[model samples]
Target: MRLGPDTLGTLPAEIAQCGYDRAGQAIGVVHFGIGAFHRAHQAWYLDRAMAAGERDWAISALTLRSPTVAEQLGPQDGLYSLTERAGAGERTRVIGAVREVLFARPDAERAIERVAAPECRIVSFTVTEKGYCRAESGGLDLERAQESFYPVLSAALAQRAARGQAGVTLLSCDNLAGNGAVLHGLVREWLAAHSPDTLAWFEANCTSPSTMVDRIVPRTTEADLQALEERLGLEDRGAVFTERFSQWVIEDDFAARRPRWEELGVQMVADVAPYEAAKLRMLNGAHSLLAYCGLRAGHTYVHEAAGDPALRQLAERLMVDEAMPTLDPAPGQDLAAYARDLLTRFADPALRHRLDQIAMDGTQKIPQRWLDTAAWHCARGQAPGAIREAFDAWCWHLADARFVDDPEAKRLVRAASGGGRQTLLDACFGGGAGAPLWPEYAHLRPLFEGRRGGS
Candidate 1:
């Protein structure tokens, strides 16, 4: 039997099922990019909130690309299993927060209607870094904006405005610097280009609060599915695997009334910038470094690479020496301890996070993860040695003919083939030899060349 409303009573006693009454709940959040991360993190938090008696914040999830998620969850009545792994221990729970899943393309009209509903107070996103369709110059690429969620959002907002309805909060849960502000800016730009009349309404009505979400959710495999079946005595296509640790630091600036998420362990703060920067620079930066360097070192999984003495040292230095110095942590924030925790999380063998998964879309990720840190040190006349090495590793990864899955792969590969190290730096960082950090990068030519010769 498949895991659904009908099979809810058949689950094993040890496995926790959704304790809340799903029929009484209403959809208040329309989430974009319904991937594993969203299911395991934000949706999980809302699930807990529901379990604790908050009934009106169920999620209506939409997939921007593939229908895999929608197909997986739709048949299961928007129910799924979340497996949290910690060392040798594991816990399983059925999450009932996602009330429905819609494929944005085929169900475009219904998706818009859902977002335009007055009860929908929040429209969140967990699209990856590249999903924003950002340009190298840091603004919305109008040409690429057509293919992004901006158009759908604009139409929904327009519909709501036409109906004289209230505006919804636009929460960005992506791993980008100032994600909320960035998303708002892009939406404004997109509105200005396509729907000029909606621009003023968006500016006055909607709120995009920055958020910092943390969780290590690996891509689920056949083994995970098999294990879940054995544990639940049913098949759950929407099952997701993640680490035991999960956190959400949301900026307290919603336009309308929201769920009592604070009571559910969410940090509703005035500003998420400090937390955001620490996660992006320290945690994400180290992940990128590990991904590129670890893959080059023939390590497939994050734990394998994090356990390697040489790779671990490089990751540690990247977080503590390079990334940590650039952050302005919030009051009571312990960055050193945070870095230590991140290193330990990266070393969690049970998570089985793959290096290649982290390596995807390097062009979209490196600027926030590494280049910004390098620029910070360059402004201070100090070279960030760890970042430099990681940058070189990224270049090496780009140059490899093993099929990079980056948006700018062709451009990166072309740059990697010509003009030596400067050319590659120019392609990746966008400033060629004239960029402020060019000198620091150029100085690493000897190191890169030596690595080429197996030093």
Candidate 2:
């Protein structure tokens, strides 16, 4: 049956709440960084958990940044829509797993105390790679701009440890190699820096389960809401749309209880390394390549980039030629096939994932995706042409006076290499630059210059 947007848009049978589930149970999980991806992925998994007789998995989604989502879900009785589209067709599901919502901005201390409750057994994060407060070299990045997230997350954990809330698993749902270890270091640094006494308790009690999550969650748009509303025959105050494929791999590090995520397509294994590395290099690394090279060249979405013969060829060459060398073969699965799948998914004509969306926070993401790739090429005595080309293009993107001046841009902005886009090549290529794609792979100029350089 269809429900108007006024009466809380219709949810599929699996996620629909009868009188009791609608009444809401106690909150067992607290999620930081409440964005569309988390709602579409993790909370959706929780909804499945509740439907399968695991009623204690209710989530209290906390927004560590803005009150926007907290405000939207709080008043809507903690219900939202998960809209999935395959081509022109769509499926809408209402999620009832979120029991409560709160913003940390106005009341940071209270927000921590609330989640530190002894019953809140799970503390998960989807704060993206930038949120973990990491350095380009993959440690606790305690720079001027990144201090807030770590200190804030640590403060909350310290409070929890103090309340003897020792049994919670701190799960990180970000895309980074060894994300759990990275966050663990940041949290340890935070506790030592501030609450030394609580450091022992947290160190002894908490578990940061490393995870590898894969999904192409394009930014939500008005069209998503309108299409979903049309399907449900009403206005949806909260609707999140994403592509069909989803994956999660956990390192199985939990000492205390954790969600039964494995029951919902999540892989729990001794080591999530190979799967994570394969995906990161082939999937996310390619995304960064496309964003710098694709978007700079006037491509708006990933599909367009994939469709471009020259760009796609370059993307494939890097993933197979440059990236594949460093990685162990993706066991049981064709690594080439996986790269092809990633290309096809990114090229989804229906998804319309923006290049600009992929392009953001490059200051943080580049060190991991591109710089690391450059290092690999440098070791082989190869020029990082494609990688350097992307870096040069990124420098152009960063070179903008307005963008360069921003606090986040500080790390990326340096004195211009004096030799122009090609010079940063030396610094990045010999290790990050000095690649063949430049001076040799000349086709890069058109890709890097784009219309901005000229018409």
Candidate 3:
């Protein structure tokens, strides 16, 4: 039978089912994105918190554009299975934290109403890096902002202010550097332009805390669905497959009462900057290196790439030598141990994380993941070798026929084709004058020329 409320009691004894009563659970969070990563990471944490007796923290998940997730979870009553894979071991659990799923397009009014509700204390987002409609200047692109969640959220906040209700926390769970501050800036910019009257109330009432979320949630395959069916005796279409390890470091600045997430292995801290920097520079930076260099080396999956001695060495060097030095880690946080743990996580044999998946939106990711680290070294009169190699690999990947997923694909392709090395560098780094590593780029010209000639 298909997994739903009714099938919960009939699942196999070994499969962990939700122990909490869903009927008594109240919707307190209105999440913007109901994607797989959110399901495996944030939703999983909230599920654990609920299972531990926090009943009012259930989620009303919103899908802004795609209706697939809403459809998948709606039929199941927001009931789905989470499979944590580590080597030969795996565990499946039904998560009931997502109480409702709404498609934001048709259900925009309903979603706004839900957010405006007094019970909704947190409005979280997992809308990816590009979803924020951020411009190159690190501010909200007013033109693009119109199509984002800003309008919907602004309307909701305006409603709440009009009713004199308490404000909600805005939590951004994307992988961008300073995600919370970026989100707040975007919201404020949007509000200032469109609804100037509401800006004061929002600034006074709301809190947007930065967060660093880490988990390797790959795209689920049909084999995974089949395994779930055979093992648990239920077919769950909205299932997610992720690695066993997960980490969430949140800034402790919520506007309203929140789930006791710290009790469930989440790190609640005063400043999430150090944690965020480490994650962006080390974990995500290494992933980008692996994705570009690994694909060029003919590896499809992250594990295969990580298992390669040369690629592994490059990854470790990038993390330990280049990225780690750029971070000011929190007290008691061991950078070396964290680097070692990351290598192990990347080598997980059970996670078939596609390099192409990580390769998508390279233009949006590379600045924080690599360029900033390289620039940091450049400022200190040190050239990071691994980053240079990774940057060259990225250029090659952009030129390849297989790469066409980035939002800036056409521009990058033009740069790769027309101006050769320097032009491409200028295009990516915003010209020689403004480029952070202009001098370094000049020094690397010979290397770029040789690689281009070989290709």
The TM-score-based order of candidates, best leading, equals 3, 1, 2
TM-score of each: 0.94, 0.84, 0.95
**Which window of 10 residues has the lowest lDDT sum in candidate 1?**
446-455
lDDT of 3 at 44: 95
Local distance difference test scores for all models: 0.86, 0.69, 0.87
* lDDT, residue 236, candidate 1: 97
Model 3 lDDT tens row, 392-417:
78888876738558878877776666
- Please, what's the RMSD in Å of model 1? 2.9
Model 3 spans with C-alpha error above 4 angstroms: 417-419, 431-455
Weakest lDDT window of 10 consecutive positions for candidate 3: 446-455
Question: RMSD in angstroms, all models?
Answer: 2.9, 5.5, 2.6
lDDT of 2 by residue, 362-414 (tens): 65566556656666666666765666556656676665433233235543344
Which scores higher on TM-score, 1 or 2? 1
Number of clashing pairs per prediction, in order: 0, 10, 0
Model 1: pairs clashing at backbone N, Cα or C within 3 Å:
none
